[model samples]
Target chain A: MIFDLVIYVLIGIGLFFNILAGIGLLRFPDVYTRLHAGTKCTTFGSIFLIGSVILLGLKMWWEKDTNGSVLALHSALALVAILLTNPVGAHAIARAAHRSGIKPAQAVIDELSEEPMNVTTDERRGGD
Target chain B: MIDVYSTYLIVVIALSFCVILAIVRVLRGPTAPDRVVGVDTINTIVIVSMVAFGTAFREIIYIDVAIVYALLSFISTLFIAKYLQGGEF
Candidate 1:
């Protein structure tokens, strides 16, 4: 009884955050902000969603089902993949955007732009 | 025992709706980076949806596929970012 409720709550939270990410992507003014919504919210939401799956796997294992261990283990592996890759991908995208000359929209203070990082790139292409 | 399969199905459907929203951003984005962001978001959501589907259907293989998809998407995102920066790969 209680287990089902917990799973429901996790799913609800995950679904809410995932939807928020989509909304944020559409509503945000600039690329950086959109990346903020796209990357962080989805990553967080995936955690909860996969976490619920992990819970279900545990429940199954508790019931003495043979497939339960496989389910829980594989789900954990997937969750780990999400946790490890999402942030690094976000950072890479943000860095590339800044390097490519896409400025933040309506910014109050710009620190990275001020202290120009000496990133070596092909000079012929020019900053796009 | 309460059945949560329907809940998982609903979650998958809702996530597909979210994918549509991201697709809008991709279509309407002003810049290349914006489109890339939309694609990245879609990838993440799809990964979660796959896992949910696996749970809903009581299949373990779908979860394995999700894991593989997550890794591949990460690679693609990195390559795209590198290409955007115009740096030598």
Candidate 2:
């Protein structure tokens, strides 16, 4: 009983934040701001949502259901895939946006306005 | 009695709220990149929701779809990034 309650709560919380992320994405003023809203909110929401699935899977597995184990394991893998790819993809998008000369709206100043900083920086200078 | 399916319904409704909000962003975003960001965020949210829906419906197929969606979105993001960079392949 308690376990089911916990899972329900987790799913509810996850869904709540996912909605907030979508709202933030819409309401933010500029590209950078939108990126901030979209990326962080979605990431946070995904954590809870995936966590709920994991809990559900665990609960099912505990009940000795074969299908439950599969659900839990596959969902975990999907979560891992999301975790690994989402941030990197966001970073790449931000970098590309910066590179393409897409400036933030209503910006005061761009401190890192130099061209291809990622390319010219010594740390990124190793492509064969 | 708050059955399991009802819980799933509530989650779906909540997630729809999010999707609406993202749509607003997509529509209102001033620049292309801003729109892209909104789209990217939507992609992530959708994947999670797909998983939720799969769990709700007790079908493994939705999870499979989510996995495929994740990979495809990743590719799309990379392609968009490359386009933004405006360089040769």
Candidate 3:
């Protein structure tokens, strides 16, 4: 019964984060901000939602159902896959967005695009 | 007390709502990257939904499918990003 309640809570929390992700996707000003919403929120949501699945499987496994063990272990693997890949994709998208010339909304200055001031000092060959 | 399937149903419906919102972003996105963001969000929501449905049904295959979906989507996202970056590849 406790595990069941925990599952409900986990799903609820995941749902909230996912809904926030959707709203943020629409409400945010620019690609970066939308990416912020889409990436982090869903990743957070997935952790909980999938975690609930794992817990359910574990609970059933505790009852000695063999299939439950399979479910639990596989869900863990799926979670691992999500955990490893989501951030990498998000980072790639952000870099691509920047390279494609979409400036940040209402930004003043960008240091990333600027050349460093002391290139000659940093590289002795530049001075020579 | 809410039954497990009922709770899963509620959760799935809520996630569907999220997917719909993402679709709206995809359709009305101002720029290409914004659309990509929408797509990526939808992909994630779908993967989670698959796992949730698998749990509700007590069939582990759906979760396995979701794992594959996550890997494939990651590849697609990377490729899209590469194309967006406009480099010699």
Fraction of native contacts in model 2? Answer: 0.82
Q: Relative to the true interface, what fraction of contacts does candidate 1 keep?
A: 0.86
Best to worst by lDDT, what's the order? 1, 3, 2
User: Chain B vs. true chain B: TM-score for each candidate?
Assistant: 0.96, 0.91, 0.95
For candidate 1 chain A, which ten residues in a row score worst on lDDT? A116-125
Off by over 4 Å in 2: A106-109, A114-128
Give lDDT: candidate 3, residue B68: 96
Model 2 chain B lDDT-worst window of ten: B3-12
Which residue pairs show backbone clashes in model 2?
A: A26-B25
TM-score of 2: 0.88
lDDT of 1 by residue, A1-128 (tens): 89889999999999999999999999999999998899889988999999999988888899999687888899899999999999999999999999999889999988788777545455535865
User: Candidate 2 lDDT, tens digit per residue, A12-121?
Assistant: 67776787777677667777877777878778778887888888878788999988888888898888889888889889888888888887779886768854555545
B42-73 in candidate 3: lDDT tens per residue? Answer: 99999999988887788889988999999999
Q: Residue B18 of model 3: what lDDT?
A: 99
Per-residue lDDT for B19-56 in model 1, tens only? 99999999999999999999999999999999999999
| Candidate 3 displacement at residue A46 in angstroms | 0.6
